[model samples]
Every structure is written in C-alpha cells, then in structure tokens.
Target: MLSGLQRDSFEYSIHNANPVNGLVRDKSRDGWPASIAAVGLALAAYPIGVERGLMTRDDAVKRTLTTLRFFATAPHGPEPDATGYKGFYYHFLDMHPGRRAWRCELSSVDTALLLAGMLAAAAWLRYDTADENEIRKLADALYRRTDWQWMQHGEATVSHGWTPEKGFLLYRWCGYDEALILYLLGLGSPTYPLPAESYRAWASTYRWKKIYGIEFLYAGPLFIHQLSHLWVDFRGIHDEFMRQHDLDYFENSRRATFVQQQYAIRNPREFEHYDELCWGITASDRPGPRTLLVDGIQRAFHDYIARGVPFVRRLQTKKEPTWRGGRGLTSR
Candidate 1:
C-alpha cells in the first residue's frame, strides 16, 4: 500500500513536468507556474523510478539532462524577467517560455532544493558515459556558480530572497525551518562559501522545548524537519548544536514526529477531525476559509495553508522572533 502511494506521488510530479524545459508545476490541479522546488523534487524522483524498474536509466538521464541544461542555459541577470540571478533560479518559472514566472523572488532555499536534486542526479548517474559525465559537470557548475556570499546581504546569515524591484527581502533564515539545506549548501560551496558563523547564526535561533513529553527542536511545520533529511543523512552526524545536545538531527526528527503525533492525540485546539489518525497538519489543503462552529466552539480554518502546532507560538509571545515574517503558524 505504501509503495503504491509512493509511486503515485512520485509519478504525479514526474509526469507533470514540462518535457521541453523540465520544470515541474507547483501542483497538478491548477494552471500554476512551474515551482523550482517541485522541479528539484522531480529530479530526485527520476532516479527512484529507474531503481524500481519503472523507467529506463537512459530515460532518467534524459530527464535530468533536460533540467540541468535548462538551468545552465537559462538567461540569468538582474532583470525582472531573467530566469535567475546569481545562479539561483526564481521561485517559479513559466511552463511555456521557461522564463521567470509570477514575478517571484530569486529564492535561496528553493535554489538549494534544486541543487539538492541536481546533486542527487550527479551521484546516481555515476557512469563514464557522455550523458553521465555531463550531468556531473552541470551539477558542479550549478553549485559553484551560485554566489552564496553575495546572498548574505552583508550579514552573517543569508537573506531569504531578492526581488528585482525590492532588492533583498527583509528576511533572514535565522530560526530553525527548512533553510538547513540552504546554509549547508552555502557553507560547503567552494567558490562562494559563506562563513562558518553563518551556520551558527542559523542555529542560534533554534527553540528547544518539551511537548507532550518529547523534547525536540521546534519548527512548527513538519516539512521543515523532513525536507533536509530528503538529501542529507543526518544520522550520527553532529554539528555544534547537535554536539551540545548529544543528539543528531535524525533522532531530533524522530522525536519531532512523535511530538506531532502526540499533539494530534491531545488535540489541544479541539479542531474537527484532529484525532490520532487524522493528525497530519503540515502544508496541505483545508476545507475552506470560513469560521465554523465545531462542538459549539468557533474554529477558524484556512484554505491551502501551512498549518503547524503552537510550539513556536509560545516562544514568539515571550520574545520577538528573529525572522521578520514570523514563523509559519496557521491560526486555528
């Protein structure tokens, strides 16, 4: 059952990707622009398809090469319509023209996700064949061309994104969220490596707390704990923060998962259908945007939002959070 579900989910992105440019749509439903993050995920999914005998290795190579070639050849400049700037692609790209779409920012985190996918393809396609060698070369070039230090915006930490109109967004990835990949990529870059203190700056905003008897690093959304794990194996790898706590990120995610399950079991907010079985509250679809009376209580719900627990809510109420946009906590 699980394998079937996985196959379906993987194929959804893989099948929806634009054949010409290799960009994947944000979702299969709407006529949305291609999400660079989804494209990254599609890159990662092709290898799995090959491994499972769902696709030929040559086909996977073609798909990966298409994506890397698009990124490598796409126009990158400071212009608003440019596909990317400073080696980071825009958050969304036009499916037809393969240009920047929706006037989105040049996202650091999204680019990291794309790079993760590229690196995965490079690692998987390790043959002396011309296509395999080209994949590795493109992946290395993509990573090297990104000016990580320039994205710092003269700060120790990296900025969230840069808009052609607004310059750098007034946001830094300080707190514990999905930016782990961004920081790690920046730190590991040979050409434009950020300072080691940048990673420390990111970790400094982490909020550790015990919720439902499980102590773990707090990032309200479940995706934050899961996305980085998709590429890097955090098992037994100790960074400065992990060394202090004597727990690796893998264990931290395990505890976080447990805490999420416990929160659903507890159902403190008393939301409708929030039992143990129906407890997944990450970025997902909701019923609607109306306030409904559930058990005589007025409960608000959102439409297509990133819902998270109130762990960071407590922290924000006590002190001002570092990230300007505030943690992505959906109000119930």
Candidate 2:
C-alpha cells in the first residue's frame, strides 16, 4: 500500500494536470503560478513510493530531481521559461506577475519545506553524487533564522507581514513542521544540541485563536507530525513544552480542509469558490477537474476539515480576541 503522502501526491498530480501549458497548474484562482505546495508534495511522494515497494528510492529520487529541474526552469506566469513567480514572495497569475513588488524575503518556513522534500528525494534517489552537505547547508540556513512567532497554531502572517494572527491550518502541513523541528533541535546549526529553554521560549510565546481554518487542517499536520517526532526523542521536555503552551490537537481543523477537498471533487468549477474554500485549497486542482476521494476515510476527513473552516475564519477575521487565544492558557 502506498503511504498517504504518496497517494495524495498522485492525486494532486492528477488534479494539477493541465493541457493549455505542459505544466502542472498552481492551485489558485487565475492560478497560473506554480508554488512550493506542488514541489513539496512531489518531494514527499518519493519516499512514500519506496515504502510501498512501488519504486526504488534511487528511481524515485531521480524522477523527483528531474521534476525539480523542470520547476526551476519552467516559465512561471507570463514569463516564458523564466525564473517565474516565487508565490508568497513573488507570484504571477495567468502569465502576469502580481502588481505588488517582491518584498517578502525568503521565508524560512517555505525554504525549509522545499529542502525537506528535496532531502527526502535525495535520500530515496541514492544519488551517489548527491551533495548531501549542500542540502544540509541550505537546511541549516533556513532553520537558524526561522520566526517561531509566525507559527502559532491558530494564526499566521497578515498580508502586510506584521502582527502574526491566526492562519489557515492547512499551510502548516506544507513545511512548518520540519522547520520547527529543526529549530527546536538546533540541528540547523553545526552544533547538534542547544539549551532546551530556547524551544520552550517558542512554545510559550506562540499565540492564536481557535477556529478551524483550511491551513490549520490540511497543512497543520506537518507541524504536528514533526513535533510528535521531537516528543518521541525528548518526551520529558516536550511534555513540559506542551503544558506551557496549553496546546492540543484541534482535530476539527484537519476535517475542515478535507471537506473542502471533497467539495472540490464534487464541484470542480467556481460554484462556491470563496465560501467553500480558501486561497490555498482552491488553487490546487488541475485540468478537467472532478472530485473523488481516493482514500476510504476521505469522507470522514472531509467532514472534519470542512467543519473547522468557519470556526477558524471567524477567529482570524474577528477583531476581538476569541476563547482560543493565548499560550499556556485559553482565552475563555
């Protein structure tokens, strides 16, 4: 059986297949731009392929490397085979770059995710010539400067890039987890371990309001999964860390994004775009769109992800702090 990551990747590929251009379309309205999500998913699919005995690690890595090359070379937006849009930093829709200047610096979270997928792909490919050191160097660079404050469970970067607020849960799934883990462990540095309190500072200071946002659901897993891994190695510290932060799984967040996926499968057109889905989820589907759950539990997951959207949106959009706000304590 394929790992969930691999299966999701294949499904994503299917959803992304577009004929107008020989490239996978990004998942956004006028979603002509490509993004880290597709790259991350593609990178994740490889190890998953190996785990299921579907492909050798070497083969999968090779394929992923080829794909990466394509992504690097492809024409993003209207530019023909150009450096293309950088999405959050510099995105182009329908062959046109956004009007705003490319101001957002390279985000550590995004870079970490791109590297994680790349490292995993390299491992699978067993490219004897693979520059593992280079990978480590880049990964290290991302982790060292990562802004933990931006990763609070319920909030995210505002459009202007200040005042961290509750964010969509799904974006967390992309790369936040890996980045967090790296920061926590101090693995981003040449030094392997650091004072545990550094991690604690982050856990303590993070803030958010509880509401089911799409990012919270679809992307949040990456953070949760990675944190779980850290907890396994340092449970005593992690347990304390969790306690300090007053964190628990918002199971509904995942459920909400899953529902949006189901909705997309059922209504692939612009039927109920904004009301139904958020910026990220809607941008993911590809040509001749149709919704179908490949996984048996997809329905359950859909309900779970779907339900959280309103609650999260309520929290993010609301000016007043909600019951879910703060760290180490609930607002209520």
Candidate 3:
C-alpha cells in the first residue's frame, strides 16, 4: 500500500512537469505555479523511477538533462519576471514562460532543496557518457553560482528570503526547521561558503526538551525532521551540537517521531481524528479555509499552511539571550 502511494505521488510530479522548462507544478489543481521544491523532489525521483522500472533509463536521463539545461541557461536578473536572481530561483515560477510567478520571494531553503535534488541526480547518474558528464557539470555550476554570503544579511544565520521591493525578510532561520540543509549546503559550498560560525549560531538556537518523556531537538513540524534526512544521512554523524548531546541527528529524529506519536496519544488539544495511526501534522493541503462545527465542536482548519505543534515551551525569564530575539526555555 505504501509503495503504491509513493509511486502514485512520484508519477504525478513526473507527468505534470512542464516539458519546455522541466519545472514541476506546486499542486495538481488549476492555476498552480511551479514549485522549485517540487522540481527538486522530481529530480530526485527520476533515479528511483528508473530503479523501479517505472521509467526507462533513457527517458530519465532526457528529463534530467532538460531540467539542468533550463536552469543553466534561464534568464537570471533582478527583474520581477526573470527566472531567478543571484542563483536563487523564485519560490513559485510561471509554468509557460518559466518566469518568477506571483512576485514571490527568492527562497533560500527552496533553492537548497532544489540543489539537493540536483546533487542527488549527479551522484546517482555517474557515468562516462557525455550527457551524464554534463549533468554533473551543470549541477556543480548551479550550486557554485549561488551567493550564500549575500543572503546572510550581516547575521550569523541566513535570512529566509529576499524580495525586490522589500529587500530581505526580517525572519531568519533561527530555531529548528527544515533549514538545516540550507546551512549545511551554504557551509560546504566551495565558491561561496559561509563562515563556520553561522552553523554554530544556528545550533545555539536549538531548544532541547523532554516531551512525554521523549527528549530531542524541538521542532514542531514532522517535515523539519524528514526533509533534511531525505538528502543527507545523519546516522553516526556528530556535529558540535550532536556531540554535546551525545546523540546524532538520526536519533534525534527518531525521538521526535516517537514524541509526535505520544503527543497524539495524549491528545492534549482533544482534536478529532488524531491518534497513533493518523497523527502527521506538517505543511499540507486541506479541504477548506472555513470553520465548521462537527458534533457540537468548533474546529478551525486551513487551506495550505505550515501547521505545527508546540513542542518547545517559551517562558518569560531573564536569562542569557539566544539569537533571533528568542527567549531561553527548555520545556513547556
């Protein structure tokens, strides 16, 4: 059942990609724009499709080449309609013209996600063929062109995004989120590397808490625990933060999964349909943007939003300040 569902989801993205630009739509519904993150996932899925006999090796190579070529030669500038600026593509792109869509911000994390897919393709499709060599070169060029330093905004951590009209967003990726890949890629970049202190700054903002007796890094959303793990294997890897805790990130994510399950079992909020089996709360599509009363209960839902739980409890106490104006607290 799970494999079937996964195949279905992968096929949806593969079939929906714009043939000319190779960009994947954010959603299947009408008027949806291209999601760079989805494009990244689509790139990663091509190899899997080949392995599973879902697509021919030749077809996968052709699709991958099309994607890399478009990104390599796409118009990049500060203009609103440009494909991207500073090697960071817009969050959403128009499907037909392959231009920036909806005046969205140039996202750091989305670019990192897209790069992760490109790197994955380069790793999996390693061959002596000219096309395969070009894939590797294109991946390297795409990653090298990104200016990680420019996104720092004079802060230890990277800013979330930048806009033509408003400049950089005020929000920095401070606390635990899916931005781990963003920092790791920026730190490891050969052409435009960020300082190691930036990683330290990001780690210092982490809040470790014991939720329902499962202690781990506190990130409210499940995707935060899953997204970075998709590309990099954190098993047996010890960074400064992990070494201090004596627990690698893989174990941290394991504990987080357990905590999510326990939180649902506890049912603190008493929301309906939340249990051990049906307890994933992340950014996803939903039915409506309206509040509906069911069984004499007032329930509020969202359309497409980043839904999360309160894993770390913020307390008002005078303590040494951490980055991003966040108060220091360990538990709820």
Error of 2 at 76 (Å): 15
lDDT of 1 at 309: 66
lDDT of 2: 0.38
Per-candidate TM vs. native? 0.91, 0.43, 0.91
Ranking by lDDT: 1, 3, 2
Model 1 residue 156 CA deviation in Å = 0.3
For candidate 3, write residues 1-332 as lDDT tens digits: 98898789879877789878789999898888999999999999899999987888888888899999999998898887888889898999988788888889999999999999999998999989999999999999999999999999898899999999899999898878899999999999999898999988988888887656677888777889999998999999998878989999999999888877876876665677889997876775776576788788776666655356532233323431112223322343
Query: On residues 26-108, what C-alpha lDDT tens digit does candidate 2 reach at each position?
Result: 55345455454345455666567678776575555455545455444344332322333332212222323222123222233
> Tens digits of per-residue lDDT for model 1 on 140-204?
99999999999999999999999999999998899888999999889999999999999998899
Candidates in order: C-alpha RMSD to true structure: 4.0, 11.6, 4.2
Better of 2 and 3 by lDDT: 3
**RMSD (CA, angstroms), candidate 1:** 4.0
Backbone clash count for every predicted candidate, in the order shown? 0, 43, 0
